[model samples]
Target chain A: MKIINFILFPFLFSISTFAAPTWYPMPAEAYKFGQLYPKAQQLLFAFDYGHALVYERLLQNRGLITDPKEFEKKILDAVMKILKNPPTVKVDEDDIAPLYVYTFPLMVDTFDWSHMLHQFVLDVLATSKDRGPAMNRRVNELFIDYKKNKPLAITDVCKTMLFMDGQFFSKDFRRQYPSFNLLIWSYHWFQIKLYEALLKPTKAERDIAVDQVTNDFWTLISDLPDSADFDMMPETRKEAPNFYKAFPLISASFDNNHMLHDIVSDILASKKVPSSEMRKNGIDFARMAMDPEAFKSNNCGAE
Target chain B: MKFLALAVLLCSQMLFANQKAILVNASPNAQFYRDLILKVRQSGEFTLPIPGAQSSLTYSFDFDQPVFPETLMGDIHDSFNPIYFFRSFWDKILFKDGSYLLINGEKLPLTCLFVSGQDNRFSDKKLLSPLLPEFVLKVYLVANDFSCQGPVKPGWPATGGREENWDTYLYYEIKDPTIMLPMDAKLRYRWNEYSLVLVDRGSK
Candidate 1:
C-alpha cells in the first residue's frame, strides 16, 4: 500500500506539473482566399517573416549598428528580396528568431494569433459573395474564435497612441531607426489598404485596386524615410474606413496589434532596457495591450 | 464499494469525453463540416479526385475548438492524420532530430534526404495556394540515403515496423490537383514512388 501510494503520488505530480500545449486549428474556409490572391498572400507571408527578422536582429544584436540608415539599407535590402520572392506559406518564426520566440513565447503567440485573425478577415472578405451582413456574420464568428484563446488574444478595446509612445523606451526604436520604422509602417499601411481594396464590389475592381494598392505600397517605401507615412502608424479606421465601419471589433484588434508591434520593437531596440529585462518588458507591455480596462473612457471612438 | 466504483468510472469517462478529437461524426455538428466542404468546393480551392469519392477525406476545422498542443503535433506525425498536414513544426526539428516514416509498407531509410518541391506555376496559369494537396505532401522520394546521414537515437528500433518509428513524418493530402503551403500542408504519395494511399486516421 505504501509503495503504491508513493508511485501514484509522483505520477500524478508529474502529470500535474506538465504544461499542456494549446493551439486552435484554423477554419477550413480560411485558406481559400489565399488561393485566389496568391501574390497578396505571399506578401503577407513575407511581412510576417520580416517582422521576425527585425525582432531577432534587434534582440540578438546581430549586425546592429549605431547608424539607422546603414542598418536599414542592410536589413531592408534582405527584406526586399523576400518581398520580391516571398514564401508561399507561413514561416516558422522560431526558426528565424529562436531567442525572440523562446524568450517571449506568450507575446509571440499573441502576435501570431492576431495575425491569424488578420487572415481570417481576409478569408471572410475574399470567399463570401455577400459583402454586407453575411460577411459580417462570418467575421463575427471568426472573431469569437479568435477570442477563444484568451491568453493569445489581443484586446479589441481601442487604446490611444499615448499608451504606446508614453513609455520611456517608447519612441526610441522609431527615433533611432526612422527609415526602418517607416518601412514597418508602410507594411501596416498596405495591410490595412488591402482590406480596403478587397472591399471593392467587383472582382475586377478588387484585382485592380489590390494591384494599385500594392504599387502604392512600393511607392511609399521607394525612397525610405522621405516618402514614408512618418506622421503615424496606419490606423485601420482611416486607412480602411469601410472595414472599420463593418467590423469595429476586428479593426480595433488590428489597431491594437499594430500598436503592440511598435511597443515590441521599441522594447527590443531601446538601450535603456537591459538585455535580460527585454523579455519581461515585452510581456508586461503585452499584458497592458490585452487589458480591456485600458480602453478610452470617452475618447474611445475619437481615433 | 459499488457507489465508489461507479463514481470513479463516471469521472474517467468525463475526462475522456473532454479529450475526444472533434472529427466527422453523425452528430448535428456534422453540418459545420458539410458547410466547410461546400465552401472549399465553391472557392475552387479543392475537389475530389474522383467524382464519386465523397467519403474519401473530409475535415472539420472548428477554429474555436480546444485541442491539446500535442494532439495537433501528433496529427502531423501520425502518418495518417488527414487531408491537411502542417509540416512547419516538423521541418524545424526534422534535420536536428531526424525522422522515420512508413508509407505504403516502405520503411524510409533515414539518410540524406531532399524532398523535391512541386512547380507552383501550372499550365492553367492559375497560381494555386501552397496549402493545397500537392503542397501539403512532403514525402517525395527524391534521393533516399543520398549523400547524407542523420543521427540515430537509442531505443529506436534496430528492427522495422510502423509502430516502432516514433518520429514519423506527417503524411497524406488532398487528391485534388493543386495545393502547397511552404512547410505546412499535406503529404501526397506518388504510386510510382510508393504503393498504397493511407487515409488520415486522425480525421476519423
Candidate 2:
C-alpha cells in the first residue's frame, strides 16, 4: 500500500496541475447595485431568457408552426410567461439555444460579451451617486476594455441598414414573424430607456423614471404584433437621448449590437441561404458588423 | 521503483512549469479601489496554508500596465479561452504554487484561487490607431471563499464596492524591486467593511 501510494502521488499531482479554463469575475465593485435596482436587474435577466428562448425556438424549429401568426402568438405567449416570472440567475444560454449556439458560436459569443458590458455599464451608473466625471471615466474605461476581445467585440461605429437589410437574406425574419421581431425591438427599447432612467440626477427621480419606463414597456407590448405603440424599431439616439448624449460611444455600440441581432435573425430565417451556408453567411455578417471602417448610412436609423 | 520513476518523469514533463513571479504596482483612480487596498495594508499579520503547512505570506502586485479596465472586460470569452486576460500578473502567483509572507515579523500563509488578464494588442490591427501609443494589461487576484452558502444575494450595501464572490478580501500594492509591474492592490478581511492595503517589500 505504501509503495502504491508513493507511485501514484506524483502522477496524481501532475494530473491536478494541468490548467483548467476559468473566467474572470466582473470588476471587484461590479453588481453592487443588484439590490438597489431589482426591477431593472430582473428585467435584464428576463430579456436574456427571451433572447435565448426565441433563438432556440427559431433555429431548431421545435414546434413546427407553419402559419406566421400562430408562430408569433405561441412565441410571444411563452416569452411573456418567462418575463412574468424570470429566472433568478442568468440562463445558461447554450442549454436553451443549442442549435443557435452551435450554428453561430462566434455570433453568440459577441452578443454575450457585449451584453456583459451592458450590465457592467448599468451597474456603474446605478452604484454611483451622480453621473459625474468619475462615472464618465469609468464608462469610458469599460468601453475601452470591452473592445479588447477582437473576435467577439462589436464595433461601435454606426452600421447602415444596407449591411443589415440590403443582403439577400435580410428582413426575412421580420417579414415572416413581425411580432417576435417587434418583441426583440421592445427588449432593445426598454434596455436603452432604462439607461435613460438611471441617468436621472437624483435617486428619487431615477426611481420614478424606472417605474414610468417599466409601465411604458408593459403598455407597448399590451397588444401583440398589431400594437400601435411603435411600428418602427427603437433607436438608442431616439429612445434614450440622454444616455446617448452622455455616452455616445456606448450608445453607438448598443445600436450596433441591436443591428447585429437583427442581421443574425434575418440570416437564420432566410431560405435563400442554404443550410450548409448559414454558418458561413452568419460569420460574414458578424465580421461586417465588427468592422470599424464600414461607413455609416444616414438612412439606417431604426425605421 | 523503475516504473514509479518513469511515471514521475512523465508527470514532470507534462505538468506545469515553475515560473518565478514578478509583480508590478500601478496606482488606482477609483475611490473603492483605494479604500480596499488601504484596509489590507493596515491589517498587519495573518497566516494561510500553502500546499503543505501554514507559512507566512506577503503579496505584492504591480498593475501599472496602461491597459484599461474595459479592455479586460472585453477579454472575457465565455467559452474555451477565458484565462488570457488574467495571465500576466495572476500567472506569476500561480507559478509560485505555495508561498509565505512575513509582515512585521509575523508569519502568514498566502493562497490564491484564480487570476485573469486582458490585452488589447491581441485584437485586430485595423481598429487600432497608427500611434496606438498605449498597451495596457490588468490582472486580478480573486481570493473568493467558495464555502459561503447560497448564490450571491442581490441586496448588498449600495454606497461601497462589493466583491462578487464571498468574503475576506486581501489586496497588496508591492513596490518590490524583484517583481517589476506597476499595480496598486487592496485586501479586505470582511466582517463586512471595505478597505485596501499596500505591502512595501516584507517590511509591511
**Top TM-score prediction, candidate number:** 1
DockQ for each candidate? 0.04, 0.01
TM-score of chain B of 1: 0.23
Best by lDDT: 1
Candidate 1 lDDT by residue in tens digits, B1-204: 999999998887665444333321212232332222222211111112333543222221112211122211122211222222222211111122233334334545432222222221221212233432222223322113332222233344654333222232232222222122222223333322111222211100
Instruction: Evaluate chain B of model 2: give its TM-score.
Output: 0.32
Which portions of model 1 miss their true places by more than 4 Å?
A1-25, A62-66, A295-297, B1-204
Residue range A1-303, candidate 2, lDDT tens digits:
232233223422232111221125455446554556676676777787678766766665623446767766777787787777654334435434545776787777778788878877887887786568888888888888888777777888776657667888878888888888888888899889889998888899988988898888877777866763565567888888878888877888888888889888887677787878878877887787788766475554444
Worst 10 residues of 2 chain A by lDDT: A14-23
lDDT of 2 by residue, B132-198 (tens): 2112222233333323221233454553455354454444233211122223333444435332222
TM-score of 1: 0.60
CA deviation > 4 Å runs, candidate 2: A1-25, A62-65, A298-303, B1-204
TM-score of every candidate: 0.60, 0.54
